[model samples]
Target: MGIFDWKHWVVILIVVVLVFGTKKLKGLGSDIGESIKGFRKAMNDEEKPAEATTPPAATPLNQPTTIDAQAQKVEEPARKD
Candidate 1:
């Protein structure tokens, strides 16, 4: 659904102004502004590295890449039996 109309917005704003005085409201606005700035900086930093870097190819270590070592060992003993 759409947002509430102007009447609801005015009532909410008046309640906020009454609950938090003019000075506190100003401080809250600054705090919210700083948080948004920090979030933007972090998002920009993440985008830069994704374009600049290529990850190394993954390699299977200490075993054949296609066959699981534990499965092979189990089957080997069954074949002998």
Candidate 2:
């Protein structure tokens, strides 16, 4: 025999109704429908590909890297007159 018969289906439905209640079941259905709609839209939108990111070229070994001297200085607060 098949796994699902009319009796089994009815019993499952009754159990679900008892657990979730009618109002919650209605809200669940609406939420599921919205999720499905959003999934479909995202799938369709994926037809257009986004731009690829490229890495920067490496600097020459001979050229020395420049350091900001100002960055090393820690300024002390001035005394009030």
Candidate 3:
């Protein structure tokens, strides 16, 4: 028989159940189920086309655009002698 025969799988299942207990196993099962459901939902959401959104208002051609930004000083690392 192959290594993954029915008897070997049954024994492995028994050992796993005995090691983890029923309550923890049940909670783990539900957590796995919820995560799988969430994954499927995210996949479905990704597959669907996004809704149309209004485009930003266009600026007047006569007005020049101004950009505001802050500059930060970066310290140089000390040279190792």
Candidate 4:
């Protein structure tokens, strides 16, 4: 019998369905499709940063004028109850 015979296809399909149920096969197919879709999206996203965009401007760092900003620990006196 030829490999492309209808009986061969039917037997192979039946075996596959019995081994991995239809629900599982469907979920696996969708998962694989989603992964491939995400991969394509990520590849396309990288090209967006290649445009001639200016680097981010820096903001001035805050420097405290008073030594109080560099506070040292001071002990509190004990209060009588």
Sort order, lDDT high to low: 3, 2, 4, 1
Residue-by-residue lDDT tens digits, candidate 3, 1-81:
998999999999999999999999999999999999999999987887665545589889999988999999999999999
Candidate 1, poorest ten consecutive residues by summed lDDT: 72-81
TM of each candidate vs. truth: 0.52, 0.56, 0.63, 0.52
Candidate 3 stretches greater than 4 Å from native = 52-81
The local lDDT score (0 to 100) that residue 40 gets in candidate 2 is: 94
Error of 1 at 19 (Å): 1.0
lDDT of each: 0.85, 0.89, 0.93, 0.87
Overall local distance difference test of candidate 4: 0.87
Which candidate leads in TM-score?
3
Q: Where in model 4 is the C-alpha error above 4 Å? A: 1-7, 52-54, 59-81
lDDT of 1 by residue, 5-50 (tens): 8888999999999999899999999999999999999999888966
Provide the lowest-lDDT 10-residue window in model 4: 63-72
Give lDDT: candidate 3, residue 29: 99
- Model 3 accuracy (lDDT, Cα): 0.93
On lDDT, the candidate that comes out on top is: 3
TM-score for candidate 4, residues paired by index: 0.52
lDDT of 3 at 22: 96
RMSD over all Cα atoms, model 1: 10.0
